[model samples]
Target: MDFFLMVISGAFSFYWVFLFTTHTYLLLILSQLTYTDQIIPFELSTHPKHCLSVGTRSRQVRVPRVLAIEGPGEANARAERTWRGRVPSERQVNARSLPQRDSLHRYEFTHPQMGTVFRLVMYAESETQAQAAATQAFAAVDSLNASMSDYLPDSELSRLCNQSGNGQSVEVSEDLWQILKLSDRFSRQSGGAFDATVGPLTRLWRRARNLKEMPDSARIEEARQMVGFQNISFKKGQKIELKKTGMRLDLGGIAQGYAADRCLKILRQNGIRRALADAGGDIALGDAPPGETGWTIEIPASQSKEVTSSHLLTSLRLANCGITTSGATFRYLEAGGKRYSHIVDPRTGWGMTHRVLVTVQAPDATTADAWATAISVLGESGWKKLKRKHRRLKAWLTETPITAH
Candidate 1:
């Protein structure tokens, strides 16, 4: 039952719509201004929900609704022109309604992918610095996506996928190699639940999902034969190879976390002290802002529409820690009145039967990301196994009621 819930949570969709606000003088002259040190008090309303107070920051800025950059290397067209168009009107309303502060400045940026929106919040020492940091963060996200996404022909993942697996080792970047090594360790520790070598199985299930049908049992068994951590061979000096030609690899499960980690690195390197990277909920936090407890996360309940609780975790303050949640709420196929999740159990060569949501917290995004998937596959037994392997890692498993809530 615990395992079932972990699986459901691991794949559930948690959507966030962030509003950023900036103050203009037109509202100040109108005698309807809320001002304090140049910062504005704005109310952000999200679709299907609303957040109140949520607290105030130095400045509030929203990303102009723009066309979303689609799959790798697409033209820089407007992603959402309507949203962009609405920004001015919204800005005016916020300017008229909200109070302003002198010293506080807020800037926001949004990117759409992974079935949800990604938001970044920046509060800088100066308005110029705030805007500049927000802009840099947005560009960094685009660059990070360009580097990590499957869209780029020259992406590390794309190159790794095309490499021959004739038992001859291929050299990869330290970053990619670290991800692979961490994946391997998780694979062994989770009893093969988190194998990166299950790329073949993932591909198969992806096709099944598109078809909205269960895969052929015989074919699934055949794919299972090729899916195992044992099939991958790794060596020193960042070399790796698959033993079988038909075997494949997919980092979709962990790439977001890795990218978040990389983004965090970039932010720190650029001397930005306090920042949060929300790569579709594979969040990485840098130093916490003064007087802030930590990043506030909404823990969604089994029902997709509601959040049962909220957690303000200081765990992000610990260097190198990342959080990943996996569940079966999104990306599933239903056939003959039965639903199969997209997360394939490599050991079984089939989609997971359990409905579980698993949230794992670990030292890095990569580890947390992979472990969340792996431990979900392991179910309760996998949970026990992971406890032995990673004493520092913590997990929370939530399951759908056999009887509806």
Candidate 2:
């Protein structure tokens, strides 16, 4: 089976932080990472639209129109042609040997964004070209963070959050519009298992985790009342209306995925096909590395073993898709004699007390990232419910969320 839930035997935290600059980036640090020993075919599309959005609603919005970098005109220019990278034929591939003439070199560069180190790994023939492309890609990621980050009070998302119950339709930029549209689709598919308008609830839970105390029931109920996808509505002309006055929107679940998608787009535009962009841990992969079957990923293996120098006991290989892991193994709160996962449930204002982890491989990071969170909240049933509609999607979990296929 392509999708299986492999229970992790240990606990690990994703604690990573470093100051960054658009100019200076991370050099390859081989000791910090490792690959999953096994390899599997990622047989998937490599087209470069860089868009993870699928199945357009006849009357709905499309991500194809703009990049939202420099108003509508710049977005139109970037959207000029759906860019894509082409994979080499089988004869041109040698899993055992590196490329011959062009001599593909593996390079790693990283910049800090969205609270984690965003790493970029790729094979390129020219270092100059690769550097320029990486620079542009990181820039794109920063631009997205500026637009979507709720932490930045002046960010577009923050400004939009202030309008939660203004009862006025606000026209958002292309980037914001596209992600919201995608969020709406996911919200509908998961039966409210995922909601972007859980800002108020998220705040309460964040404070709870910070204080190592349970939030008051009265406060949770009040916040829960403001959390619902139904409170927000999309309108024509790329506008959105927040039906409730005190509502807030949060894209924490999907921002990394969306950022990964955008970076891949920038990479592809620069003719860099064999690429991988990791936003925190949410990764978007391109064509397999030259002469390689797929990228190797180190998957967590045991719950009984204590996490030390290496927590990953097994590895898996994949290509041409996005993959991410979301779980209670790392972030959580312990107060009042019970552990609470950092992944808060929108339906309830409390952090999930269950110890579970979900990993999803999808067509793009945006899809993988969002679904991972939804599945964690929805548990095993979420997989069974949405698998039929998302046949191409594959998932693995640290808990028995899905029986082995």
Best by lDDT: 2
Top candidate by TM-score: 2
- lDDT string for model 2 (1-405, tens) is 323322221111212223333223332232111111111112233222221111110122232221112221112122222123222322322333322223455566889889887877776767988999999999988898999988899999888878877778889999999999999889888888788998898888888878878888899899999988887788999998888878888999999999988888888888888888887778888887543456766556555424342444655567778888787766788887888887888987778877777888899999999999898888886678778888888777674221100
Q: Stretches of candidate 2 above 4 Å error?
A: 1-102, 301-305, 308-314, 399-405
User: Number of clashes in model 2?
Assistant: 13
Worst 10 residues of 2 by lDDT: 32-41
Cα deviation of 375, candidate 2, in Å: 0.5
lDDT digits (tens) for residues 300-396 of candidate 1: 3353323223322222223336676776756787877766778888888878877777777787776778888887788876588559757888877
- Candidate 2 lDDT at 213 equals 81
For residue 293, what is the lDDT in candidate 1? 41
Q: Residue 69 error for model 1, in Å?
A: 41
